[model samples]
Target chain A: AQSVTQPDIHITVSEGASLELRCNYSYGATPYLFWYVQSPGQGLQLLLKYFSGDTLVQGIKGFEAEFKRSQSSFNLRKPSVHWSDAAEYFCALNSGGGADGLTFGKGTHLIIQP
Target chain B: DTAVSQTPKYLVTQMGNDKSIKCEQNLGHDTMYWYKQDSKKFLKIMFSYNNKELIINETVPNRFSPKSPDKAHLNLHINSLELGDSAVYFCASSHRLDTQYFGPGTRLTVL
Candidate 1:
């Protein structure tokens, strides 16, 4: 079964500091990867996605992720995170096909210290 | 205009009762999905419909039925709701297997 692992349950970073959220997936073949952010009491917003394209993919709110096939990882990174960036970050994978649903990680709670 | 929306942002119901959550998307997407977010914030896909046709039912219980009235609307009906059913439900839509846009979510609390 395809699964996602987000090692960090929670991460704390100072405002305006760089941020990186780790994500690893277990799948038989290369799958579609995505990053989503959910603010408190709100729905999730797609930050970015990786299909068949350049390894490094950029997303909204200055977020970016790199799909390293060899590493089986799709880590989200931000040059500088604002306080508004503090939210739950989830890494998801879809193994193609219309019947397949996105397998999401446990999610990492980002806390931006002001 | 909201791209995707779910009715009744909050719902409180008693166990064994029946309830429904409605979802609609104006993005003209062909696929609609239902996801459950537990208390731990673990999100899982319960069902997916493509063009009003059920395509994915991820071993969800029969008590939880998803009805896609049309290509733009998908509703989830829960029967005999249990305490464990208390969580946030999200509706999402996309163009086939493309990026999905999500609704604000409905928080269901079964007491």
Candidate 2:
């Protein structure tokens, strides 16, 4: 079975500090990776996705992620964190398309400090 | 504009009862999916429909059935709701291989 792991359950960073969220996936073939953000009382918004081609992909709201096949990881990063960035971040992967369904990580709760 | 939407954002029902949650997406996506978020915030896929055809059913109980009236709508009906069924249900839609847009989700509480 394909599985996603987000080692960090909770992470707190000061405003303007750098942020990184780790995601590791287990699959047999080249996987399609994605990152999503969810705000309080809201649906998840897609941040970025990596299907093929580029290993580093850019997403919305000053977010980016690097897909490292060598490490079987796709870690999300932001140069600087903002208070508004506090939310739950989830990493998902398409083990196989056409209804295989995305296997999602438990998610990481991002906290921003003043 | 609203991309995907689900009705009864909050639902509270008793055990052994039946309920249905409706979902509609205006994004013109051909694929629709239902996901569950548990109390611990763990997300899991329950079902998926493509072009009104059942494509994915992931270890879900037969008591839970999904109905797709058209390309834009998919409804979930639960029978004999149990306490374990209490969770946040999210509806999402996507094209053949594009990004999926999620709805605000319906919080179901079974007592």
Candidate 3:
């Protein structure tokens, strides 16, 4: 079965520091990869997505993700983290057509320190 | 304007009660989905509808049913809700094989 894995359960980073959240996926074929963030008491927001385009994809809130095919990974990163960036980050993937639902990872809890 | 929206942002109900959560998307997308986030913050897909037709249904309980009256609307109805059903439910919509837009989500608490 296809699955998504977010290795870190919790990551603490000081504000203004660089950050990286690891993600790995298992699928039969090249899959559609995505990164989503959810703030406390909020819905999931799309951070970035990797389709058939360039390996590097940029998203809102100064977030970017790189999709590596050989490693089967799509990792999210930011140059300078902000206090507002603390939230639950999820990595997801879908292998089929548009009708197929996404398989999400357990998610990583990001804690921003001042 | 909200691209996708869900009604009853917070719902508190007793076990065995039946309730419904409505969702609508104005992005003109033909596909809508329901995802459940547990207390542990683990998210899972529950159902998917494409153009008012059921396309994907996970290993969800029979008490849970999804109704898509039209392409722009999808509603989830839960019968005999249990305490284990307490979780946040999100509604999302997407065009064919494209990025999906998510709603604000509905938090359901069954006591």
Q: Which candidate is the best by DockQ?
A: 3
**Residue A49 of model 2, lDDT score:** 98
Model 1 chain B weakest lDDT span, ten residues long: B51-60
Give the per-residue lDDT of model 1 (tens digit) for A8-105: 99999999999999999999998999999999999999999999879999999999999999999999999999999989999999998774678999
Per-residue lDDT tens digits for candidate 3, residues A1-114, read 999999999999999999999999999899999999999998888999998889999999999999999999999999999999999999999886658988999999999999
DockQ of predicted model 2 = 0.78
Model 2 Cα lDDT, one tens digit per residue, A58-94: 9999999999999999999999998999999999998
Window of ten residues with lowest summed lDDT in model 1 chain A = A94-103
| Candidate 2 residue-wise lDDT, B1-111, digit = tens | 788989999999999999999999998899999999999989999999999999989898998999999999999999999999999999998887678889999999999
Off by over 4 Å in 2: none
TM-score of chain B of 3: 0.99
Point out where model 3 deviates above 4 Å: none
> For candidate 3 chain A, which ten residues in a row score worst on lDDT?
A94-103
